[model samples]
Target: MELSKIIPVSKPVCRSSYPDNPHSLCRRFDPPLLVCFSCKGQHLENRRYYYYCATCDLEFHRGCHLFPPEIKHPFHLLHPLTLIFLDPDFQSSRIPIDWPDSSSESDDYDSYEENPGSYEGHIVKCNYCRKYLQPEEFGMAYYHCSTCNFSLHRICAYIRPPLAIENLKCHDHTLTLFPRRVPLPCDACGFSLDTPFFDHVYSCLLCNYMVHRTCIYLPRVIKITRHPHCLSYTSSIVPSCELACGVCRKTVDVNYGSYSCTKGCRYALHSKCATNKKVWDGKDLEGVPEEEEEILEPFLWIDEETIQHFSHDHHHLKLRQDGGSHENKFCEACTLPMTVSDRFYSCIKCEFVLHETCASLPRRKHHPVHKHPLTLFHPSSSNPHKVERKYYRDGFFTCDGCTRNCCGFIYRCSEQDCEFQLDVRCASLPDPSIHDCHPPDHPLFFNFTSGSVMTHHLHFFIQPHHFQLLLHHLHLLPHHLHLL
Candidate 1:
């Protein structure tokens, strides 16, 4: 019979035991030569239909197993969603955008459930092509509305955008689609509602302007990592100087919306701080194509002060003045805790170290608490699940600067409404502090890095006005620091 000579006598649809083979059973490779978690594409190169779980090495994709473990959608008909695949970043769900489109169901939808794939930070997006659903598209997934715990992006729950948005671009009229989802603030970019969904913006019943589909075109001229010039976009400015914000140095509200620097220079930047997701990379580079400049990797010394570290291969890192590791150590590059009086930069023979100011960091800087520039995320952890979220290794999230609750290497808040955090134990403080504390070895200067928990509380010694004297409030603690 011509059923491909009897479909090769089908069999192997499910057998399992995988987390790398806990003792064999394998099978199920079905016909997916590699690339299917559900339409991330890959029909044949070896033919694979997927389903392998293998305890958790996971695979699945018979169209993500014919979907529908429970979905309902009308943009969130108030719960009935539960399909889940993992990687909503911290995936406790929450995505459908502001939710509450109601249709009934609330009580947390009887505890949802489906998760289990093993989390790992992929960043999800795609409330309908806001892009980033990638991680090989999580094997055709992205749902979870489950009564408003929120979720959706296995292709925006199966495609649906387009109610109105024509002509748009500095507009001559025609721009509808703000009908719901509020949080305003983007008459071109005063930044409110950084969008993942909330309809991403595009209004104007007739006047006020409202752009942002990533700020409708806007870029009379750009270029920003924190400026070298090129900014341009000036619709208005009164600045006699000090416009602030070369990158979150704050104080840039000249009425609203700005970019400044077509040579009038003095440098500015905030239309949401020049669209920062770590300072613009969402692109609209306008013309694009000449790029290719960032080379810089030099300072890697071993002479004037030791170097050599492609992440410690064999040995040769040098610089551990008091490096660390009598045991409780840690900072192999932001793992946190390494206080032996801190100064770091080791590798004399084994324990491998660094924190001699994290061996020079500043592949980018900024940080007056967050408007953009802390960007180094992933300074280490080649694996072991990186920082491991959903509350791994404890700590989870907290520490806009010692408000407490610690994990490691966050430094986030590239705007987009995301709050702000620090946690690398206050990103490795020691600013002007040089051991021995008050008096004696003198240097103590830490300035309370933007504390929280009350009116204010960061004072890391703060009294070296060149040493005018005041030394009392020092509340420091990554491992130790007295004098409060």
Candidate 2:
């Protein structure tokens, strides 16, 4: 008999117990035809072999049976990892491990006090991918070490990255995988020495170039919405004066890695802040040619004082330095009541109106809070029925930045599936902003570390000029306002 025929005739004992049957024997199927009970799909379009149960009509991939009872993963070798199935239902009877009853209040308090770091009580995530293990119907099987409470997905267990990496972009010498977490500063990004590990750390003993796994692949050159020119990743920035981040308006430590302007400008951003998913577009523009800048005009000039605005194109708006005085009339862009001392644009034929600042807003611009370029969008101007169902469900959308619901013109992200929207007020504030209320020389900058507006010598809100200005400052400024 052929070996293929003989192998199919053999039956294997399945570790998984079937309902009412303590011992379930599985038979090999030469050509898999049914969906796998664990994975919920065929292995390879009926090409691979699998184990099937005739009584329950359930199927399992051949690899599922081949899983060893325990494994000694190279990354975590202090203790052996055991194979276990994590149930998704949250009420499964097959608990991975049983804990002694912590009903005694003193025992719980004593255990927590001894090791507070281990009792974070966060949801279990895969040690490899750092993703929450949301198991599917039949429960997701993975390798677990109960002693350390470390777990890895089934796929990550079998597929391991090389132990040693050479010719890495961030480092010069051959970097060996450090296997476990170490309290050492990463040379690429200034983290993990004082702070917790961002991911796995790779180390070069020869050059002392220790770096995080994720930081090894940091883009050499990239463009962010915060700056005008492209920025290149730099190991350090030696400035005569203290350097503040252009994005968060926080101080940039010169000793650490950061992204600096390529045009020799006095602008720099923290490595972590520059690569924030909401800040960078995630494209590596190392050798790519820069495209010609697109025109960002909000309207075409019909005349010097009159123009056809993009949002309210149905009528020509006439610019007015002073809008006289109106009680009921409101600026259509900001949804604020028109004031006598406001510079605004009024529609030539209709009640449509806009603030001068609002009308001059470009068709597309980048807000500091979002990664993608935001387009000037009018909820009422789009498809009336479509907008009604999508945005006007409650007659207003909650602004992602400020969390205030407003019925006004919004700067919405252009990317599909991204619903990030910013109200006119929050979108207009410039980073490292200078306000006319203070002085021209003193620019107000926000300090992310101290969580305060660093005015240096100027006093902000010492005496309020108006209630509206005070309200705006109170709403945006953080709790601890440092005068310095």
Candidate 3:
């Protein structure tokens, strides 16, 4: 057998050196022919045999039959796994070994073989339960299992991708996916993403801010403190002279982001302090709880049973209609004036009365706008009363639960180390509610309360009613209600 007769002599030669000529009588050898293992059909002639199954007569080309060495799965985003072909002798009989529906002989094979570059194939695995996927289930990534509902795309199963979160501007970094398992902070919103993340992780280099990749893009404007106005972001620092946030009574400073009025009328908040969702617990105040119900002796027209209040502490507290007073009476809780009210909480001792709406505020709260819980605070905890120089001060404190500023009546933690606070209105809101004025069975609760009156109607009316009903349903006394 002449080797030159069968082999093409003018083919582009490879760099490797080979024998120029072979003996003419070399046992009449012929190149091995490659065939498909399942059908035993001739796939390629004259190629090195790769995949050979003795029990089921088959063969494959070396290049055509190779598997990937390492693969990164979306389901397991933390680490990349190596692909290993299962051996026949392995004990796991449940594992699928064969390709699906390869019996359809058609002319498409010729086209695919001719244009190998255009041919595409993929491998998949389950996200929840680690199961190797069949080729037929390639496109059904989005549709999850009916029983277990574990479904994902090959890319999603292998490499966890990043999702866009809103509003929450994490510390200095933009949140992104974590490559390897390392204790890193989120880039977009400063949070720890070390816990169980969905599929993606956000990280930062400068600070210890890490969070879920889905938590990066939080909403910009949010409701907080149950105020009529919507709290808008202010890039500038809060005024130092402002003392505490209007919602949570925490110290407003330059370090954290602040929310304030565009008109700059002494209204300001720490970004996290303003969005508290609960009422303050009275552990932070220094004085003992007042027992006696105080009613104005001058306005004492009603009987003793009808009047319920702390009479010894207050001098001139009185009941007034909502938006009834022209003169701005400073609130004992927030040290502000009563603008609108269906009811009012007044101090008979010092002519101080908050709007009825303001009096029924909460002590602590949790907000959607913030990641953590917040407490409320009153004004006079540290600072003296601006109105009465001789009177003792009592006010709310802000909780450091979230990143909003304290704006309205606040709920604060008793712990000196933890200055957590939430706005009174924020704290008093329920998770869900049904209203008489609005549609029946309508799920309502205190959401965030922005300062803007035009857009935030829920804070003005819905929040007040919601708090009142909650107090009534909880079986709290009117005096105890003031503690909210």
Candidate 4:
């Protein structure tokens, strides 16, 4: 018979037997096919079979079969292969396999009549890193190397499967592979993991925290009262303070973590402050009503040509056109040197004048810790019990927000119901502020008489003059509310 049509048979090959059932043969339309030792066979698909080697075309469905055994592989000239009966010792038996040189045509089986000795002892290679390893390194159906820490199962090495499942535990939404780097922070800890880390992420819409796919299962509701709304990870940038952070008390750049507002106030909280438990008492106080409406007045009257600022004790303060001359002038607020340009207050009579920085001090402010708002006082009233009074004797007011003494200017409130106050510098602060400038949408509003008093801290009261100045700078003309 011709070798191609012979249908090579094994010596007493094993097979699974089924009870005389007519439907068994009919059900085997697509029979389980197997190849073993240069021979192939077709068996019933439902049978319990084993030992079908795809490399040699030999089939063995039952356990009782034994066939002629070959001790050596015809293709391998140097190394002899062996059959494994049980768990083989990989540490001692592992060996590397070499590929035939690309230039050697003699290794091609079709061209050469004899065995090419090229397919005898081949080892599997890792698909990801492309490193080859010995068969002994793979003990079971699949295995991995402990030394290099490279790993893959037999099916895993050949298959390119998706890395993530549809519903993972870390997040509420399905996680997809993040093949590219994201510009925002992580949804979990708010850390910037845009570097080399490979994983999935879930983003929240309420705060700056970006959670990784694994961190999505973490609790969503954190009990932080510093913010009026519950904090969540969001993509929005928040309004920040001009000075250091109010909570961590650390100076941070604006690009870091930000808190979100639920009231649509366009306000953002610092990450630390967002998680704080202190609640803010929501109270909006209107300015005190005047018995007879006083005509609104400008804080200072100036001529078109030049304006001079004079102190009661000073002879005269002449205005200078050069801003560089006032570069080193002192600010009335913190008593720091004024480095800003454009204007200054001078008394020509006593040759004494306040810089533009001193003249810009705020008259009122509200603090988180204070119950009532504080006001700015011209030659601020004496508070003998308070340490700030010592500095107040020199016509300076202490900032109720920070409790620090200031000389540039001061603010105060007259109503005994509201105690809130601020130094000139603190009171002039703008809402929804960024550095020195305030956003236009949320213009500053001033309250002089019944200055708004926060309910949480009744002792703190809003100052009117500072609020009025801030409004004036915004170019908002006062109607009923008069400047103090």
User: Could you give candidate 2's per-residue lDDT for residues 284-386 as a string of tens digits?
Assistant: 9999876755977988899889999888889899998766654468777667776677777888898888878778778788765577888887887776643
Candidate 2 residue runs with Cα over 4 Å from true position:
1-72, 76-159, 193-198, 239-241, 247-250, 325-327, 384-391, 433-468, 471-484
Q: What's each prediction's clash count? A: 20, 0, 120, 67
- Of 1 and 2, the candidate ahead on lDDT is 2
TM-score of 4: 0.27
Per-residue lDDT tens digits for candidate 4, residues 1-484, read 1111222332232223222521111111223534322112234233333344333334542211221222222122134322221123322221111211112123222222221123235455542333343333332222344334434333233232243434333344444444234666664445554534433444434333354553443332332323333434333344344433334433434554444443454445454344333322222112322132233221344564234332222233445546566666653333444344445555555434455544433343344333334444444223544424433555544555546555544555443544445654445444322111444333222222234321121233344344444455554422212132
RMSD of 3: 22.5
Show the lowest summed lDDT stretch of 10 residues, model 3: 110-119
- Per lDDT, the best of the predicted structures is 2
Better of 2 and 3 by TM-score: 2
Q: Each candidate's lDDT (Cα)? A: 0.49, 0.63, 0.38, 0.37
Whole-model alpha-carbon lDDT for candidate 1 = 0.49
- Compared with the true structure, what per-residue lDDT tens digits does model 1 show for residues 181-246? 446667656666445543456677767766666566566566664454456665446857657565
**Between the candidate structures 1 and 3, which one is better when assessed by lDDT?**
1
lDDT of 1 at 318: 65
Error of 3 at 102 (Å): 14
Q: Candidate 3 on 1-484: residue-level lDDT in tens?
A: 1222332333222111123831111111124534432223343332222344333333433321222233444444445444332222222111122212122222122212111111134344455334444433322122233334344433333343554333344445454444444445433332334444433555554454554544443334544333433445544454457554555344566544555553345666654354333322212111333233232231333342222232213344456656456246655554445555435655545565655444434334444433334444445433342212222233323333233343444555434444444445344444444444454434443333441111122333333423455445554423223322
Against the true structure, candidate 2 reaches a TM-score of: 0.64
* Candidate 1 similarity to native, TM-score: 0.24
